[model samples]
Target: MVFNRPKKRAIVESGDGGLGLGIATFIANGEDLGPIIRHSFESGKPEALMQNLRSIVKKKEVEIEELCRLHYEDFIFAVDELCGVLVDAR
Candidate 1:
């Protein structure tokens, strides 16, 4: 019998008043998730990339005009999504 251990999840800090919150504050208010999004795209599977970007687009619930007005603030995220999806292809 083969026993496979579950993979460990990444540690994500979260808090409203602690250092976690402070970091979140900067990232959230900074209006930029570019670097991380790029990293995510470069690291993840391809299918995952597309799904992620599409999901982000859907979740934002904004029209193309609004997206453009926002200057594609979430574009990197979409790229990340695409990367993931492509990388995972067999």
Candidate 2:
């Protein structure tokens, strides 16, 4: 008998306040967060990057709060719902 393991989802966290909030908001919106974050890190000026991140976080504050406060299962469900919206919109 073979047992299948669950695939691990990548959790992106910058550990800084604004950047982390921005990343979480992007994930909740079903937008890809990797490239922008990568560019920020490579820019060698995290403070400037964080200023931009804060703007994003402010723009999506409500969604960010809702997503952040969810339990793990609820969070997964919420993300799935957002993804469904993306699929339907395309």
Candidate 3:
């Protein structure tokens, strides 16, 4: 079996990691997240974020699967960690 490396995504600029801009830049990706944010906040449902992520990423099955294969561990860990933090704050 062979591994294909994912291209480096520049989600963080120097010194910005501590400022929370890394994830912001990663998710923004040239599109305004305002509507998604407002809707999810208004809906107040955890699935709102999941559904948005599904629509954005799952539409391309091949890429999605490959991405998940490569990134799922780290991604899921981040999600789980954030979930704990978010749930605690609620």
Candidate 4:
């Protein structure tokens, strides 16, 4: 689905990975997320994007919670490892 952003004049897409997971994966892979998020808001789809993000978070909550139990550095490292997988996939 395409989310129209009138302000930024961009049409952000919720990609093929179901809902908006594709976009999230893209961002997690080191792509710049700020522009996409800003455009989503500018285009008036903040709630939609947020919902998708929340879903993604929920799916990862258990994993993230476990990571949090470790040291902060470990959590950061785990995140980096996850994102790195995406980058490698690309």
Report the lDDT of model 4 for residue 65: 79
lDDT of 3 by residue, 36-80 (tens): 456456756546455546655655677768888999899999999
What's model 2's overall lDDT?
0.67
- TM-score for candidate 2: 0.31
| Arranged by lDDT, best first | 4, 2, 3, 1
Ranking by TM-score: 4, 2, 3, 1
* Candidate that would win on lDDT: 4
RMSD of 4: 15.3
The segments of candidate 2 whose C-alpha lies over 4 angstroms from its true place after superposition are: 1-29, 62-90
Q: RMSD per prediction, one decimal?
A: 19.6, 15.8, 17.5, 15.3
Please tell me which predicted candidate would have the highest TM-score against the true structure: 4
Residue pairs in collision within model 2? none
Error of 1 at 63 (Å): 10
| Superposed Cα RMSD, model 2 | 15.8
Q: Itemize residue pairs with steric clashes in candidate 4.
A: 5-43
**lDDT of candidate 1 over 1-90, digit per residue (tens):** 999865443324433212222233334355355544554456554454345456556655666667687867588789988999999994
